[model samples]
Structures are given as C-alpha cells and as structure tokens.
Target: MGKTTNALENVFELAYNGKDYAGALGRVKAFHREVAESLAAGAGPYMMADVNEGFRDAFEALEAQLATVSALRDYDEQYDQVVSYGELLASAFVAHVLNDLRPTRWLDCRPLLRTDENWREGLVDWQATEESLRSEVLPRFQEVQTIVTQGFVGGTADGRTTTLGREGSDYTAAILAYCLRAESVTIWKDVAGLLNADPKTFPDTVRYPEISYRETIEMAYYGASVIHPKTLKPLADRNIPLRVKSFLDPAAEGTLIHDCQHPPLAPAFIRKTDQCLLSFSSKDFSFISEENLAVIFGALAQAKLKINVMQNSAISFSVCVDFSERRVHQLLDLLREQFTLHYNTGLTLFTIKNYDAASVARLTEGRRLLLEQRTRGTFQFVCQ
Candidate 1:
C-alpha cells in the first residue's frame, strides 16, 4: 500500500520489510487486482506489483492447514519458503509495469544480498554482502533510473534461499543505502510518519517531523513499531539519513531521522503487553553476587531469553522478559537447583523515553503501576 503510493509520485525505488512467503497470496493477489482496477478507472495513479513465485504453494497449503492448527511453528519453515516468494513476485511485476509506462531495467535482489544459512533469521555476512553489492548490483544500477528489487529475501552459501528475520526488508533498504552510498533511504508506510503516540491508543497524537538517530534507536528499543531495531544500525553507522514517508501522500515531507544532539525530547511512550515477569532467589540462602548473576545470565542467553529489565538485591533477583515457550521452561528447570522461581503472566510493561512528570501521568493516569523505575531520560512501569 505504501510503496504503490510513493511510486506514483516519482519515488521510484522501494524496499519492503516482511516475511518473503507467509501471507495469504490470494489476498495480496486480490489487492493487486484492485490496484489495477483503480488505475484503469482513473481513480488512482499508475503503480506496479511484485509477487514472489515461491509463495504460491505455501499460501494454498496455509489455507488448508488453517482449519486444523493455529500454531505458527506448525508451518514455520514452509511459511518462510512461501513468504520469501513476495520479493520475486514484487520485483518482476514492478519491472514489467514500469517498462509499460517507459523503458526501464528491473533487477533481481537474490544474488545481491548474500547471507549465511540461518534460515528465517539468516545473518548477512557483511563482506560477502558488500562484495556482491559492489560487483553485481551496484554496477547494474550505475545510471540514474528506477530499479525495483526484493528486500527481505537473500541467497544462502549453497545456493538455497534464505530470509532475514521477520520484517527485515527495512534493514535491506538501510543496507543498500550504506553499500551504494545513496542520498537517503525512505520507508513508505501507511501512517503519516512517526507519531508521539499511536493514534489508536492516544487521541490527538502529534507527528514528529524530525528526530535524532539516537532517539529513534531508543524508541525502537522500547518496542516502537515504526522502524526495526536492526534497520537503523547500518544507516547510523554510515551517517546516512533516513526518512519515514507516507505512501498515501508521497509528496509530504514525512519524518526525517538523522544525527543530532537532542536534549531529552518528549515522553516517548511504548507498551509491551503480554509479558512474563520472572524472579529467581537462591535456594541455599546464598548472596546473588556478580558471579551467580553472570552464570544465570549465561543460562538465559543459551536459552535465548530476552531480558527487558532486571533488579537485584542481596539474595534474590528479578527480571521482566518475553515468553518464548521453546526455552523458558528449560531455563527454569535448569535454575531450579540454585534458585526458587516465581512469575506473573498477562502483564504489560510501559516504557517512557525522555520522560517528564506530566508525561508519566498521561501514560499511567488511571492504570495501576505494579513496578516502576525512573532513570535520567527513561521511566518504566509494569501493570496488570
């Protein structure tokens, strides 16, 4: 939706950030049909569609499987294989559409972004990615012309397909800007741009037209959905600018994220709902010192448990974390010998970046705050 809007207004290149093969192809296919109809009816400007060939079978199977199981992991691998197909579908369709409008060259992105075989969460071997971009993709894109390519999908070492983490296409755009040294990377979204608060949650929300890279990173860390955490790293590393523009209004200025010294800005609000707060206390009445904490942290790392906040006293320690069933139970069992455990589920953690007294009140006004922490520029509260 965002991409099509921007493309009509002379914003040519687009990078998507989503699973390559997990969504309903029929819905997306239908969406493209609607776009085609709208253009034909003169109600919309001309735009293109890209669909990945890999997703067709997976989408069909997903419909059948939906009747039986709702578990995401049931078809994680298959879903990935299918979701990656969007890149292929999108790039090819865009190439054709643009050519119909005027002469253009479309590029396939698979051979461009080389990565390791971590499957759904494949890590980009930077040297490999850089070499390919410089040698293969960059040279092809030398002249100033519109180029369309898949974003979140890449090729593995053995020539098999792999995908970046879910919603990783944003990272792909940043990487491209870093490698090609583009003027800027713009992420076209459905919304106006980065808002002070989600309009759905807080009415009369304010749009932030400019934000420092550090502030953006902090917001992403606290669960802001506008940008991915990894997306900013490459752009920030190269001092490249990024913009989150509205696909609906391609000509709007949108929000710009760049380097600056932003003095404690607005009370950045974030809510992490559906969480588990876990506490571990020594069973033998031993002090939970640095060594003990270190060991426990290592176990948490091995289990892939992400800790959002932690507090420790002499003999007991507590941490708020996300619930990933695959490893949390195992970690609890392993820690049983050294510590007693307690936890609370169905909790929401609210974080305020660059907080003030009034900002805090506006967020937790009527809600009960169970755990509260205040830092120089941040405040956090856990509530039911």
Candidate 2:
C-alpha cells in the first residue's frame, strides 16, 4: 500500500495543481479494471464473476469519494482515505486468485486491527487489537484454508481509516504473527536473504544465512531498507523468529533472525536519503542542560518526529531526522518559542554496523560529513 499510495499521490498532486481530475480519475478506473480483469481472466466463470463484483465495489467506493473532491484538503486525512483503496482493491483481487488455487476467504483487517486517530502514522492499541483478533480473526482461520487480508491499514475507534506510516506492511505482518503466536514469519523478497549491503547500491553484497534479533534490530534502526524498523519489536518481544526468503527461489534456505547470536562477519551498510539536520540552539546563548534536552525531545515526541541520530554541545543540539514538511513545520512551531532553530535539508545519513577501520574509510572517502558519531560496533555520518 505504501508504494501504491506514493504512485497514486503523484496523480493526486497533478489534480491538485489544476490538472483535469477527470483524467486522473479515468486513469485510476482504468488501472483498477485492468488489474481486476487480468486476475479474473485466469479464474473460473463463477470465480471471475465474484472477483469482478469485488473489484466493482472497490472502484465504486473510490469513484464516489474522488467525485466530490476538486483539490487536496486536509492532506493527511485525505491521503489516508484515498490511499486505503489500494489495499482494499489489492486484497480483493489477491483473495480471488488464491480462491482459484484453493479455498480462501477475504478478510477486512480494519475491524480487527484497532488503532488511534493518527492519520498517517497511527499508534496501535495493542490490548484492543489482540482481543479483536482473538475474537474476530481466530474463528475464521479455523473455517478457511486461507484468509487474505490487507496490510498497513486499521480503523480508529470512531471508524476513521488510519495508516501505520510508509512501508508499514512488514510491521503489519509482524503484528499478526505476534498476536497469533505463529512459529515464524517469512518475508518474501526479491533477494535471497538479508544482505550486508543493498545489492543495487553496492556490488558484491554478502547475504546472511542467519542473524540474531539484536543485529537485525540494529540494522533496521540504522535505516536498512530490507525490513521495516517497527517489525522486529513485536516479533522479538514474543521470541518469534523471522525469515527473509527469496520469492524467486523458495527452495533455498534464507536468512533466519532468531534469538541466538549470528552476527554479521562484515560491515553492514545502511543509507537514509532526503534527511533534514535540525539544529536547535538556546535563545539566550545559555548552556544546553538536561532540562533543555528534555523540552526538545518532548516537542519532538509531540510532533512525532523520529530522530535518527543526534549530537549535543554546550549551547546547540543537532539531530538528523527524516524530512517531512508538514511535521517539520509543526515541530518548528512548537520549539520556536524557546529555541533558535536552523536546518539543513537534502542530507543523507550513512551508517555502518560492525564496522572496521577499512570499511569506515571506504564509506566516508568522498562524502562531505556534516556530523559524525561512533560507538564500539557502529559508525554513523550525516553527509551532503
């Protein structure tokens, strides 16, 4: 849904900028129908009809909503509402395809995964979610050979749609695995398994046959693209193992992330692009004490700004965070009353885990570093 939403948002942006909404709507309708038809073409007659109806319902809902909109308003709210169609349409089509192979039931996950009112990044009410799953999802699992559900979406208590941030589907899978207490959760990817470096970015990538939960978490925290950062916590909490396997070659043994120590023998690289380095200085040139740090952190929390890396000096504190205009402005508004702020955008954060001197020199060779931090096992740099 995250990727789909991003693609659709480009269309939405065009419409908002005074491009013909009809053209965008037409494209959306055509894309939806095209996907549905392609799926239904291989299905049996009855199954094709069923799939068509499901797709029709999804299309109708989106069309009705889009028909009333002339421009983007309440960006996050509208984004949540509009983008959710992707999951609905996708799951419907997938369920039909799976049913053709075997008995399968389509499950709407909104009712089962209850969350707070946060639009783009909702906080889960775990107790409610667990209870709802136990009561709603468990019984259906017993009746059907397979239950197909959408990821990255949940419903608020007041029945509003909410998303769990971008690339949150992995977290969704982990949530289900944790609540269900499943033996293991396997994430099928294009690559064979977890790699020391992203294959596309760096050549000679080394795949990990096995990794510990702690190492995986560190990799994720350092902005690894292979897995969602939030995914490991729930699975780790329950001691549920996670497997990263290649969809192209399912027979091969993939990377296993379990409780035992199987640390990477080589440095693991992670790169986060399009970051913002926010510098906060005391208004009166006073020293940055613990109280100042607490206030800044509290404001960050209130604005839901995730700090990737931070450094503090006597009077100034600088932090690297993902660049989000709306949220950044919100944070600035909260802090402007007490602090002098400066920010540098279009920065990249690079991290190397289990780093050696050679790997550190290679990673930082040509980059102009804005900030650097090091620990016993890891090195991080904010660079232009």
Q: Estimate each model's TM-score.
A: 0.77, 0.93
Clashing pairs in 2: none
lDDT (Cα, tens digit) per residue for candidate 1, span 54-153: 2344345434433333233433334344456556655655665665666567766777788876666668888888887878666665562677777777
Alpha-carbon local distance difference test for all models: 0.70, 0.86
Tell me the tens digit of each residue's lDDT in model 2 across 73-175: 6666667777787888888888888888888999888888889988788889999889888888889867889988988898888777888887788999998
- For each of the candidates, give the backbone clash count: 13, 0
**Which residue segments of model 1 deviate by more than 4 Å?**
1-83, 90-92, 103-108, 117-119, 142-144, 262-264
Listed per candidate, the RMSD to the true structure in angstroms reads 7.4, 2.3
